[model samples]
Target: MQPTSELVFAQLKSKNSNTRCFDCDTKESDWCSVSHGIFLCLKCAGKHRGFGVHISFVKSVTMDTWQFKHLQMMKAGGNEELHEFFDFYELGNYAPEDKYRTKAAYYYREMIKTVSEGRVLDREKPSIDEGKIIVEEQKRVMPQKVIEKAAEKDPQNIKALIGDAFEYTKDLGRNIKEKVSDVSIADVENKAKEAFSKIESKVDSWNFKEKFNSVKTKTEGVYNKIAAKAKKAMKKITEEQDFDDSKLVEGEDELMLDPQGKNGKK
Candidate 1:
């Protein structure tokens, strides 16, 4: 393949006035060659394949930055130049020479900065009550204070030591509830059951039954509410004429009951 400039040089000098290509125009001569040929003229071609276009003939450090550049160009905030830079930045050749490595490094640095700025790290902290822990993460600030506390008491006074070490029950409850608010109720119930089982192991069998029944009652109430809402939505959809029967039948296992024939009372 002839170099881009050579191809353009030949096209520009070609006798046919038809050689001039226009990107915005559909004229046949507007694009006599492939690639940068979409727009004719030395100046436009220079801007695209030469001039400000960065071509790294070297290949030392990773060229991963170029890959990210392409991705960003494909997803940039409407920056045409940056998109083009990403698209054709590696026009010349790659490997052996270490020239392009510098340019590649520059783009890689930009990518690292962009990625770092967009990420948030997770941190774990001990809760005040000491019975539970809090895991936190966000754009800024430490979560240590919310979880851990310090207290001092003379060894001679056990009551005072317990009092100082124990977090207020109300405060602990509020903090625990808030921490688990994002988890599903089922998850909370599972955790509670596990804890209950742990306690039952140390206690008599009769005590376990009462705790189990209490948990079951709460779970049933939740299940009833969810089932009721789902049934209501299904009823509404069944009443709608536009609902596709074929698609409905495709999910037969999900249906609560067989669809009675088209007639009433099914």
Candidate 2:
């Protein structure tokens, strides 16, 4: 039997996490991406709309009516699960390299197909107190007296520390690029390394090399797989052009590159 609109609304309300926008972290979600089974704020929903229906099938949570199929898609995915997938795949990092989202389409297809097949796509995170997560975030950026106090007592949070450190560099790069027309790669890299080094000096337990090596391994594995698929997609309609090699006698001292077909007859 098909579910009614009221039941879908009830399901949406039952999950407390559904109240938060998955993308912007807004307090209230007025829209949803039915394709991904994640809630969105009005602002984020508009952004998703720009991504095209192939990326996100968005609709209003309160205003738009829902069908049974939509509910099934919603059940297959949720905010946190998709968040894990996004973080694991490092989709944000791909945005710069993938302006056309040609490779990104493969990831979306794989994730959705896996989810619809009822298979897990990401590693499950161990349960942590919600307050601690909030405090860890605040401690990185807010610089409040209370947050600093909390951080002094809390065990080292490596993920948050490194993630924020990278985030700072990303923001710095964007700001610098906007102001300066031409910025060299070395300058940005040096500045980012300097910033990250300062943060790493403070964290005693974070083995950045080990973590980076693991990331490098995972990234290469995924990249090689996708590259194989992409290699097969190229379409060639033209036959090979055979160039004349008669212009060169055996053991020619110099090869002429002039357009004139008459050799030495200019």
Candidate 3:
């Protein structure tokens, strides 16, 4: 991670698309999101961090230590590849509620749709304009680091996915049976099987396990800080209650605080 940062910065600089921020195209870009595999300027980087690391993992190209896998993801997609996949009407279409930036929307909805289909990422594809052929130049070669969920080994997660698929299948089977009162049990079973197969396929296809882990860890940290502050507030309230009885109540103060009389014959 230490010396690898230097290598990452050098690789990113080699591309023209990496020259500017992928989000705002701002000059002097220095930050990036490892999750989405896009470079970002300083300000947009803050927004990505705010989105939570699970959705977007922001890191400095020069300041932060780098991992080899992180660099590979960045190469898989930068401004050029993302633009080609998204086909943005506006160059910097970032907003406060950037659905396009969310992990589900980006990794699953749009980009995944393209990948799942027969079509490739369209990186080297040519776009025709006025009958003039134009081919997008390949800036840098990307690694074959596949996108997958890191949670495949967790049995609980696997069970949850299968459970969800079953629930959906049940609903579909019921609907089919209702539409045709004479529909046989075998027909309904077939429908359920198809439904389960499609659902299971989607689950297996979009495995985003480790990316979410990074976000989950940071989210837990934020909650832990809040819990600590809540405990401090409770302690202060307890102290305040003690002060109230000591200063305001005459007979009740000893019973509430010490609960013993020093002058008593014990």
Per-model CA lDDT versus the true structure: 0.28, 0.48, 0.46
| Backbone atom clashes (below 3 Å) for every candidate | 4, 0, 6
TM-score per prediction, in order, is: 0.18, 0.39, 0.39
After superposition, candidate 2 runs with Cα above 4 Å error: 92-110, 113-266
Q: Please report, as a residue range, the 10-residue window in candidate 3 with the lowest summed lDDT.
A: 240-249
Deviation in angstroms for 184 in model 1?
A: 23
Model 3 Cα lDDT, one tens digit per residue, 29-136:
677777666778766765565554445666767655566666666655576876665443232343534544433334423343354343556533323221122223
lDDT of 3 at 142: 12
Error of 3 at 229 (Å): 15
Q: CA RMSD for every model?
A: 24.5, 21.9, 23.9
Residue-level lDDT of model 1, residues 60-133, one tens digit each, is 01111223333222222111222243335442233212312334323433443354345432322222232111
Off by over 4 Å in 1: 1-204, 238-266
Clashing pairs for predicted structure model 3, backbone only: 148-207, 149-207, 149-208, 149-209, 150-209, 150-210
